[model samples]
Target chain A: MTSLTSLASSRTPADLLRTSATAVWIFLVVATVTSWALGTDHAFVDNTTAASVVVLLLAFVKVRFVGLYFMELKDAPLPLRALIEAWCLIVCALTVGFFLAG
Target chain B: MTSDVIDAPASPATAPGKKRRIPGEEGTWIFIFGDMCVFAVFFCVYLSARMADPAGFAHDQAELNQNFGAINTVLLLVSSLLVVLATRAVHSPALKRHAPRLLAGAWLCGAGFLGIKALEYAEKVHHGITPQTSDFFMYYFVLTGLHAFHLVLGLAMLTVLIRFASKPEMSRGQFIFFEGGACFWHMVDLLWLVLFPLIFLVR
Candidate 1:
C-alpha cells in the first residue's frame, strides 16, 4: 500500500483536507462510542483498569489525529514529522508510564 | 558540461523558495509540547488525588452530568467536521465559491458548543453542585473552563477566517493562517475527547 503521506499529497488539495478532517471525526466518534459502552457506571462514577486502558489508548489515537492531519504533519518533510512524533511519544509515554508505575 | 543537468527542476542545485526556513512554525510545535507537559502534570495530580481518596473522587465524579458531557462531545465532533469541510472547500475551484458557507457552518458549530457548555454550567450551579463542593469538582471546573475558553478563542478565529473568506482578493497563502488556528482548535477538541472519558465516563 502507498504510504499515508504520499496518498494524501497525491490527492487534489481539496480531497486531502477533507480526508484529514473526516478521519479525525470518525476516530472521535468511535472512541466516544467505545468509551460510553465500556463505562461501568452510566449514572455514577466507577474506575476500572480496563476503562483506564481504553481511555489512554483513545488519547493516543487523538494525539495522532491532531499531529498528523490538523498540524499538517502528513505534508511535512520526513525528518520534521519524525521529530514531532518522537517528542510526542516520549512525553506521553513518560507521563502515562510514571502514573502507571506509581 | 553538467550545467544543463544542474538546471533541471529536480536538481539539488536549485534553490527552494526563499531559500530560508521559518523557525516560528517550529517554535509553535515546541510551545504545544510544553502545553502537553503542563497537562500531564495536571493529569498526574488528578490521578494521585483519586488514588488517595478513590471514594471521594467517585462520589464527586457522580455529581457530574454525563448527558451534557456526551452532548458537548458530539458538538465538538461536528465542529471538527465543519473545520475540515471549510479547509477542503478552500481548495475546490467550484466549491471555493461556497467557502463562506463552510466557514460559517464551522463558526456556528463552535458557538453552539459554547452555548451548550454554558447551559451545562448553569444546570450544575442550579443543582447546588459548585466547584468548591469537592476536589473533583475543582479539577472538573478548571479543566472544562479552560477548554471552554479555548473554544471561545477558536470561534473568534473562525470569525476572522470568515471575514477573509468574504474578501475577493484573499490568497491561498492566507488560508494557512486559518489552517494554523484550526490546528490549534483541533488540539482543543482532542483534549476534550480525553477529558470527557477521564472525567465523566470512567469510574
Candidate 2:
C-alpha cells in the first residue's frame, strides 16, 4: 500500500493555476452567472417550468464539477468515484422529478 | 522537506502499477455521504412543500435577493479553488511554503460567505420577514441556517488546515486527517451549490 505521505510531487504554483481545478473554477463561475441571470427577474427568458429546470440542472452540473475537480474525486478510486456519481444522478433526478411532478 | 513527505496526488501521472486511491480516510467518506443523505432528504421535503403551495412558494421566493445568492456562490467557488490550490501546494516541496497563505486566503473567502449570509439574514429580519412569515421563509431559514452552521464548522477546519500547512512534516495519520477535513470543506460548498438554486432560483 502506498503511504498517504509518499505520493509524488510535480506541480508548482503556476502549474496549479493551469490545472484542471482552475479550469473547473472558471466554468463554475460562468455557470453561476448564467443561473443567476436565468433565475432573476431581469432574465430574458420567461420564468416557466423549462427555465426552472434549466437552472436546477445547471446547479447540479456545477455541483458535479466541484466534486469531480475541487474535491479531487476525478482521480479517486473507482468505487469512491462511482458512489459520488450515483449521488449526483440520484439527487438531481429526484429533485427534478419532484419539480416536474408538481 | 522532501516531496515524498507530503500527501496527495501532485502529479497528473501516477506511477505504473500504483493503485488508484481515495482522497481521504475511508471512514471520512462514511460521514461525508451520511451528511449528504440527510441534506438530500431536506431537499425533497422542501420540494414537496413547494408542490403543495406553488404559488405561495414562488411569490415568497421572489422576495429573495438573487444577487446575494449569486455573490455567495462566487465566494464559495473562490474558496474551494483556494482550498484545491492549497492542497496541491501541500504536496509540492517548492510549493509547500505557499500552502499556509493559500489556506488563509480560503479562510477569508469562507468568512466573506458568512458575512454576506449574516447581512442577508439581518435584512430579512429588518423587513419583519422571519421564519414565521411563510412556509417558504420557514424552509429558507431552516435550510440556510443549517448550511451556515456547516460553513462555520468548515471555517474551523480551515484554521486547522492552515496550521497543518505550516508544519514541516506530517505523519500519515495527520495527512489523512487533513485530507478528510479538506473533503468536508468541499462538501459544504457542494451543498450550497444545490441549496442556492433550490431556494433562490427555482420556480
Runs of candidate 1 with Cα error greater than 4 angstroms are A1-20, A40-47, A87-102, B1-24
Each model's TM-score? 0.78, 0.92
Q: Which stretches of candidate 2 lie over 4 Å from their true place?
A: A1-12, B1-14
Task: Evaluate fnat for each of the predicted models and list the values in order.
Answer: 0.25, 0.73
Model 2: per-residue Cα lDDT over B1-203, one tens digit each: 46456444433335555456788799999999999999999999999999999999999998899999999999998888888878777776767888899889989999999999999999999999999999999999999999999999999999999998899887666677788899999999999999999999888
lDDT score for residue B139 of model 1: 88
- Candidate 1, chain B, TM-score (2 decimals): 0.82
For candidate 2 chain B, the 10 contiguous residues with the lowest summed lDDT are B6-15
lDDT of 2 at B4: 52
- Show how many residue pairs clash in every candidate, following the order shown: 2, 0
Predicted candidate 1 versus true structure: per-residue lDDT over A3-70, tens digit per residue: 22233233443453436456666777777766665654542335566566666667667767666665
| CA displacement after TM-score superposition, residue B150 of candidate 2 (Å) | 0.5
Give the whole-model CA lDDT for all candidates, comma-separated.
0.64, 0.85
lDDT of 1 by residue, B43-112 (tens): 7677777667778888878777777777788777777777666655554444455667777877777788
What TM-score does prediction 2 earn?
Answer: 0.92
DockQ each candidate and list the results.
0.32, 0.55
